[model samples]
Target chain A: MLTAHKIKVFQSLDKKKFRQKYNLFLVEGNKTIKEIPNSHFKIREIFSLDPSEIPTGDFDTTKITPKDLKKISFLQHPKDSVAVCELGEEKFLANLPIQIVLDGIQDPGNLGTIIRLADWFGIPQIICSEDTVDLYNPKVIQASMGSFLRVNVVYRDLVEYLTHSDAAKIGTDMDGENLYHHKFPEKFNLILGNEGNGMRPETERLLTEKITIPRFGKSTESLNVSMATGIILGQIFSHKG
Target chain B: MLTAHKIKVFQSLDKKKFRQKYNLFLVEGNKTIKEIPNSHFKIREIFSLDPSEIPTGDFDTTKITPKDLKKISFLQHPKDSVAVCELGEEKFLANLPIQIVLDGIQDPGNLGTIIRLADWFGIPQIICSEDTVDLYNPKVIQASMGSFLRVNVVYRDLVEYLTHSDAAKIGTDMDGENLYHHKFPEKFNLILGNEGNGMRPETERLLTEKITIPRFGKSTESLNVSMATGIILGQIFSHKG
Candidate 1:
């Protein structure tokens, strides 16, 4: 039985302030709920309209009515299950072969897609500037499609992080060396910027090198940042083969 | 002069049946509206909250109040400028080095992103299955970020189009040649499938070859359709260099 207080708490998870206050985040959709047990995340509570939709686990689940579910669901088409997950302590694991650094990616979808791409390329960690979209944003989690469980994303001062890194700090620019010809170092930090503005001027100053995806067409001004990340990662991994 | 009937028509363009009845589409945002004069599509009308926001061209602009713009706007936050563009006759230009084919794609954002990727790589055309999301969806236009002005996307019966084409019909699958190793033909049709179900069995049968992006990670089941397209296109273009 979900009390009005519990409902209010679940609804609060949608905002970053509330999520940070409670140290909990929302995860909806039956498939994603099932994935939580295998990940490092701890599920504080699970609510489902249908009991069967809840994953087979030792955790307790509260069966809620459709009306109650509607009040707490974030999706336009709400799924059968929703979980309140405890935020894990993120560790910045340094010295990886390829570490993705996000300068200020504002779009939840773009951040989510980048996390998925990082997981696909077997990148274990991502370091983001403090201004980047919150990793626990419901849209980001939805777009990530469970890859958030595998990849570790930690927020830090980009200037401080880049300054301490001994590895190559590569930032993308339109006028930089062609990505096709640029050779990535064995250990490098690949930094992506915001959706509208590229990287912040201060952040761009720390770059050890700059690279670009050469445009084949005449009119398009730029590729979507997430698409650019995927294209660049594809080139990097193909060299290993 | 803005009239009530004109508002109804503009609002109606958000739906497919109404857009087809009028043979028109909505292009919003000041930046996207500016690109209209250079494209092949004709502007039926331009309405802007500020006349100065309208693109400088031989076209006439009708100044309207924000309240009037709100009724016809499809976005959450309405832009100053909106234009009704006439739908152009899309031509299927075959015998190109590479063409993109979308099979039952449902998301407008994915469609838009793919169109942008196609524009970035200089791929002129995208062939879509009849059931794919309509190209004129407001979300598709917004997500595309103006690439729709340059690329031609046409809807057709996949079986008929694939059967008639002499070029290699390539599909992506897990059990397939690693994209790093696959050699794409000079003239080929690259088909991306539905977000949830992937290619229909009938559609999959028409493929002349299958290629897969080798996953370096174990958890991610797959990449987003648009992201995969970018990764593959990146590989294809790098070989050209």
Candidate 2:
């Protein structure tokens, strides 16, 4: 029961330019949609295979067949529902206790997992280099597992942000001080780098301390960016606790 | 040039049954192939788009076009080289310090990342439930980076294995002891469960201790299985240190 015009609009939202121009992004799957009611993001509209499966909200929702849902879905196996959501306004936490800064993180899944990790450790916000993957990328949203609802992800010039920040800057590297022995300050900006390369040279220059998670075994040259983020965040939380 | 018959054999190795029947698996990408020299696994043969890109090894190497490599490759964008390697012989560590036991882990990527995490923390071996994804799945190989070369992954009945082992059994759960404060034993079995479900009820019964990474923020229901594994392993290593 989807019109051609409607399908075109839904498909366009998948791209970054369209999402930016319209200020709307797609949130697919029943599980992810359920979280929208409690989130600050406003639901613009929804298309669902089962109307009952759609969470109760004031937003306009249309019932459609699974076949019809697939036509506009970004997922290979489209979930029972897909909702269009307006981008939430960014809240600048000036005195945030701990902030995570990402430098040119290319992988959407890695970015999403880092966002989820930041949420688990109660890190309020994530500041990404402008070149990092789009915050609303479908893969990123899916991997975030609804933590995107709680964490504020803002893209900015990471070099400028780090250079101006007064909080201690911690950058992860292979040849830095051992993570286990290093003590994190009361307030710090934990910077994670790209998948292939570590932090950018410009961002690296601004770091106050460089920390390394010692490799206990051979063969692994480096940990995945997201896994490193989780391990580093875990160490920081344990230290603070 | 890859023969039509040989290409069929290589393509078949993408499946679990084919890998078991032939006792061979595919290792794609330049970075992963470089690790095979240091690994215990034997290389059957390698096909590379550029012969110069192939690492110097005792194994037989064949020059092939990128188009030919794609025909036999399991990856969407096949890497420069693909090496067909024999499965390594399993080493039975009778008194392993810390063994990671996976129960019904479905995703190849999650299993691979967990293997990488185990390697990082110096966990010697991983025991997977019989129903878990095959260790030789090409996706697993890609996600594990090259950690699959160092870590030993064995498939078995998780419940039976845990019940028979004298090592303290620690299972991760939602409502459990805070991981930050809990003490990990010198010899222990750390069990992680499926991506969607935490642990099978039967496997749950075998656990001697249940530990959790406390949720510091609201809205995040759970952590990705691999991310959780990394965080837990990080805490365990820190505790040991």
Candidate 3:
């Protein structure tokens, strides 16, 4: 029988406060869970209906029924398993290369995709607004495809972060400089905004420059936030080489 | 009263054979429906739970109960409206500055996202394998966000299409040239494979040159197929500028 303490602790990890209190984040789905054993992250426990496929490790685990698993899963239909890993605090940014600031991207899929973008370009850190979705959101973890393990995402007020960074602060906007014409800075923070709203007006003031991708047609005024990140990152990294 | 003939047509559009036979496809949600008004294609019908917002037009419309809409909607929960469209056969590549080829992309969402990416970068046409998810699949239409309106997508045997192109034949692969170091051709047909299993061995043989994204970490073997397309396109467009 599962004790109330374990169940309650399992439930609390979903919130940022609980994740902070315990220094843990949940990774869900059998495939995502399996990848954990291979990761550098320290696993706290495995909560699942079956443990046969999971590797035998030093990590603590509690066998729970499928119904018990469902109660905590973010998916409408829960996967066979989920694992908890210690959340690493963001390390000091080494001046090595390109940096990204997620202004207020709210979708977990978009955030994860952005993190995956960062991992591909070898970007070291992504600073996020407190309003941005939690990096620990299971959906973000799933979409990231283990990239979350590598990329450092720190949450703080983006405006404050932008204000402090000596790196060029570039904001993506429809009315900004055409990306084709603009020269990229070697050291800079690329700020991409929310899907619905590009960037807050205050965030706009913080930008050292604003860049735009020319519209191919007006049918859709802009690309999806995540796609824009991929496009921008590609441009920035290609310039580096 | 809804006639059996109309129901037959609607039901048939769901299957590829019927869609091919009649050259019909599906679109969903209000934004897409509205976007179609400005598109070059013709509409077959509007099926909606709410008749109040639908425009008066020559197209046939059936009032569907919300319960009935769920039966036809590809989404777990149905959108407010869905429509059938006559897939237009227009060859926009009278001349090709740039082209995209999709090799057996099975997922409709990824295909749609790629299509949207092409539209954003102003790439002219997309060539897909006959096995690719239909351009008119509701999931593709919804995800494309009206890109199908401006962009032309063609279906052919990918091996034949690559062999026949006067432009450069580019394929992305794991063992190929690093995208950053490789010299990019001015006019080329960029081919992308499916999500998990990449280009067929036969398909890989025809590639003029294969290219790979240099991943930063050991564990991340690949990017999501859609993400790969975005990264590649971003590089392509940035170079053209």
Best by lDDT: 1
In model 2, which residue pairs have backbone atoms overlapping below 3 Å? none
Candidate 1's C-alpha runs over 4 A off are: A56-58, B56-58
lDDT by residue (tens digit), candidate 1, B94-212: 78879899999999999999988888889999999999999999999888889999999999999999999999999999898999999998899999999989999999999999999
The digit string of per-residue lDDT tens for model 2 on B175-213 reads: 889999888888899899998887899999989999988
Give the whole-model CA lDDT for all candidates, comma-separated.
0.89, 0.87, 0.78
**Model 3 Cα lDDT, one tens digit per residue, B1-108:** 345676667666767788878888878887778778777888878888886777657797778888777766767777788877887875646448678888889998
Q: What is the lDDT of residue B61 in candidate 2?
A: 89
Stretches off by above 4 angstroms in model 2 are: B56-58
TM-score of chain B of each: 0.96, 0.95, 0.88
Worst 10 residues of 1 chain A by lDDT: A51-60
Docking verdict class for candidate 2: medium
Which candidate do you rate higher for lDDT, 2 or 3? 2
Ranking by lDDT: 1, 2, 3
Candidate 3's C-alpha runs over 4 A off are A1-24, A29-40, A47-56, A61-81, A87-97, A217-219, B1-23, B48-55, B60-72, B76-80, B89-95, B217-219
Q: Regarding TM-score, does 1 or 2 come out ahead?
A: 1
DockQ of each model vs. true complex: 0.75, 0.69, 0.43
